[model samples]
Target: MSGATSTGDVLTINGTGLFVDDRGPKDAPTLLFVHGGPGQGSYDFMHAQGDRLAERLRVVGVDQRGVLRSDPLPSGAPLNVQVLLEDFEALRQALDVDSWTILGHSAGGGYAIRYAHQHPASVRAAIYDCPCWDSDGTDRYRLPIAADLLERYGELEAARRCRELAAKPERLDPDDQSWGAMRALGKRYNELFFHQPDNTDALDRIGSQSGLTEDQWRRGVSHLPLLTEMYESKQHLLPELSQPSLLVHGRHDLVVPPDDVQAFRDSVPNGRVHTFERSGHFAYIEEPDEYAAVVTDFVVSAHR
Candidate 1:
């Protein structure tokens, strides 16, 4: 909350401290934002669009159970898909909200989908932005696209590095500098996330502006094990999610392909897909106005 203009608070739920930044009128429809980066905190999203979306809906950006601003989980804490879902439920109950919409970005989409499937009664609707449906899809579809984009953008060295990393069948430990370097390269060449190459700076700026400390960022990345668990146990449970859902993806998204979005549309009973023609992984960042309009329309219509 250091750089946030919105009201922020820390809630101790199930012995873990979760940080939340709440904006907009309290009476407005609530949206719980789940950011990507099994480790990335919600501060970036809050800094980027929290206030903008807050005008029409109460936006609550949260640093997951052990991300920036939140107390770090124990080194041997039990982490799995179900535990994460339970964390969301505890936050919802502690907030005293009957139910809320979930806005999940990138990897966070997995969490949102699973939560909707497991706790349909607590979720009114779900909005996924360039979501990674599952680990298999990401490994099969997204990574190749990302490498291709890097090569096409003249980042040949980055592309080479990525390819080398990809070729390694063994999983790299989260604490490894090589893994972090690969992640950085991926972010650098993810063209679909921004309309212009210069705009890519927004990605890092948001995190810096949000006042995320170095220690917080490191602690967040420590959850790489959780990410690995998600990838290994990934499931295509879209059909099980009964709540209304909106799937938004960039046509050029290297992280989540259009085909995956289409698959999500095909599987979910109440779901629709919107393609950002000129955008990529971070559709909301690339086309904020349009993204907001689409989300507002979808949520409003779903409630009616």
Candidate 2:
């Protein structure tokens, strides 16, 4: 399992083309990254941490089907957890890797879990970074924490605004711009996941440098149907997963609270939770060095 020196071009799998950015030694243990976002691509992960992780392990970041640089599905492509899992299996076979560890972030973590469960023999281990395993838990816990953080920051008006928006069902419709508005308001609150308020600057820098085009963002958001189906069909499968798992979470993550990670820990017999006390949702970004170390240590120790 060796890595390509440069980012590889798009490869088609299951009639859909996806972008893969590969790095690290070709012979090292391969770690495939499944980026968060029902539509977010792999660009940010590559830009921020790919090289660092590559020093020890072969790192490959994938833009899942329908994400940035990946072929978009038809307006109403029939997508579900099964479809996504099949796409991953196709990618694995296409890449010709005997097995690879999986690192899934946010929503991508859900995909990683499913893949590991369905094809446990193909996965060496699973690393979930600030994962969103259950949408109901996310909706239930996120807002109150966001409001509290806002009030602490003296943004009472913003706090009130988020509280009002939180009362409604989370909108997945691309045309309904309220979800965008809610996200804009919640951005600062998400930054609070860092122990230091100033660490939010890192997020801004990563966003600007990552080259994630507006079109890609729109495409990612448009896959609301996939998200809805995931919520409805996948919640029950968490407890049945028995693969080796490492659950990393931020103590203050409003987007996917620690409680959800705890539930994940409770379900998976081989699972263990590691909380970044000073971090929130994006622990990898907020605590990059420690994040890499934790991931490296876990993958090496588990595989050994």
Candidate 3:
């Protein structure tokens, strides 16, 4: 693990009510990291990765609308996908970088793909680390990951409910207690999928980023129910991205799965895939050396 050396500024995207953590050097080629969570920001997790990535390239980490340090919570806005994509374009202009690359993980992957599709000219290259490609696609793709959940909890009823929710996308009532339990179980399952040594801390931070207290977080768990909807709708926009791309996924990734990775490889006109052998969903953390190498190699190859 590398010790974090910090030098960054927090700025707002004008009129959009969102914030971004700009790291690394101004002169360095900008590599913007679009975090997942239509609402979750890229503060801690992005910073953890940025601490390493910034050393090689300027890492721009953004907290999407509604997440930490960003304004206009999804609760306060219309919470549609188009609004978010526009916010991203606005962000790039506000930052004033002529051309840049973007890397997205998990939900961020979905965002990254959409952004690249709409703004291909501005992107130097794009990387999708287990992007949630389509809403229906994710349902099929996540079955195995969900199996890991059922295996851990052995709650047939809960598993059935989860499967139903994932199968049929819908906005859950954020105030429902059962929905909170469902979300907590999902988070636990995601950690198990990653198999990281210190998953508890990362999971805790992720759970905390909702800008809500423990009770509120659990109580409002269904607020992000749209995740399933957004994820399933992930694929149709793939053809729009013409930028050179890399899709890094763990063969054993229980969350996004290798099958989904393969689908991406086949869909993108200019895309490549790097499979991590023993790692799971969070390959960057599980296989840090390999993850860094893959990203560095792709970035270097593109620049050449």
TM-score of each model, paired residue for residue: 0.85, 0.83, 0.78
The lDDT per prediction is 0.73, 0.73, 0.64
Clash pairs detected, candidate 1: 192-280
Candidate 3 lDDT over residue span 1-304, tens digit each: 1112243344555454555666667777678787654454566545356666766777787666655545445444565556667777777887888778888877778878877887878888999886766544554455535645775777676667656655555533323233333454654655545655575356466555545354433322322755644644666666667889988877766446556666676788898888888767677667777777677667756655
State the displacement of the C-alpha of residue 240, model 3, in Å, after optimal TM-score superposition.
Answer: 4.1
The TM-score ranking, best first, is 1, 2, 3
lDDT score, candidate 3, position 20:
63
Ranking by lDDT: 1, 2, 3
Please state every model's RMSD to the true fold in angstroms: 3.7, 3.9, 5.4
lDDT of 3: 0.64
Residue 264, candidate 1: alpha-carbon lDDT: 79
Identify the runs in model 2 with alpha carbons over 4 angstroms from their true place. 1-6, 149-181, 184-189, 192-195, 233-235
2 versus 3: better TM-score goes to: 2
lDDT of 1 by residue, 240-274 (tens): 77888888877777667556766776788888888
* Residue 155 lDDT (model 3): 62
Q: What ranges in model 3 sit over 4 Å off?
A: 1-8, 72-75, 144-152, 162-187, 197-201, 205-232
Worst 10 residues of 1 by lDDT: 173-182
Among all windows of ten consecutive residues in candidate 2, which has the lowest summed lDDT?
172-181
* Clashing residue pairs in candidate 2 (N, C-alpha, C atoms within 3 angstroms): 1-26, 2-26, 2-27, 3-26, 39-220, 193-280
